[model samples]
Target: MKLVKVYVTLKESVLDAQGEAIKSAIQTMGYNQISDVHMGKYFELKFENDYANLEKDVDLICDDLLANPNVETYRYEILEGE
Candidate 1:
């Protein structure tokens, strides 16, 4: 079995209201060293031996369904042996 770790984040050109709010709140707490923040998502896709090429499968899933091409970008890593 393999575990696919997928990370999805909005494009840098897009505004991250939630992240900006968090950064602002944090700075108000007296930690002023913060530069920038971006909000993102993560998911784990588990696959058994039934898949011969899980990497390709995961890429297809990300491209076709899991991520929006215009506003979002994604990257994944596969962990095996569990």
Candidate 2:
């Protein structure tokens, strides 16, 4: 078995309202070093070792289903075998 770690985030050109809200709330609490914030999503995909094109499959899923190409971008890594 293998573990796939996927991270999805909005492109720099897009606005991050959720991240901004969180940063503002934090700053209001007196931790005022926050200059910027960005929000994102994470996914862990576990699959058996049967598939030959796991990386390709993951890329396809990220591009087609997990992320919005115009507004978001994604990157992934395969974890160490246990």
Candidate 3:
């Protein structure tokens, strides 16, 4: 089997409102050293090892559904799965 780890994050030009809120809460907790926070989404996908078009399909999935091309971006890593 194969494991695909996907990470989706807002583009640098986009505002991360949720991340800002979390950072504010964290700062209230006395973590003054915290400078910035960027929130993102993580996804884990498992597929049969024999999938011939795994990379291409993963890119398509990310482009079409997982990440928004207008304001978000995604990256993935393929790994061996138990």
For lDDT, the strongest prediction is 3
Alpha carbon lDDT of each predicted model: 0.90, 0.93, 0.97
After superposing candidate 2 on the true structure, give the runs of residues whose Cα lies further than 4 Å from its correct spot.
Answer: none
Cα displacement (Å) at residue 62, model 1: 1.3
- Candidate 1: tens digits of C-alpha lDDT, residues 1-82: 8788999999998899999999999899998999887889998999996798788889989989989989999999888847
Candidate 3 per-residue lDDT over residues 1-82, each given as its tens digit:
9999999999999999999999999999999899999999999999999999999999999999999999999999999999
Model 3, 48: alpha-carbon shift in Å?
A: 0.7
- The residue pairs that clash in candidate 3, if any, are none
Q: What order do candidates take by lDDT, descending?
A: 3, 2, 1
Clashing pairs in 1: none
Candidate 2 Cα deviation (angstroms), residue 55: 0.8
- Cα lDDT of candidate 3 equals 0.97
- Model 2, 45-78: lDDT tens digits are 9978786899999999999999999999999999
Better of 1 and 2 by TM-score: 2
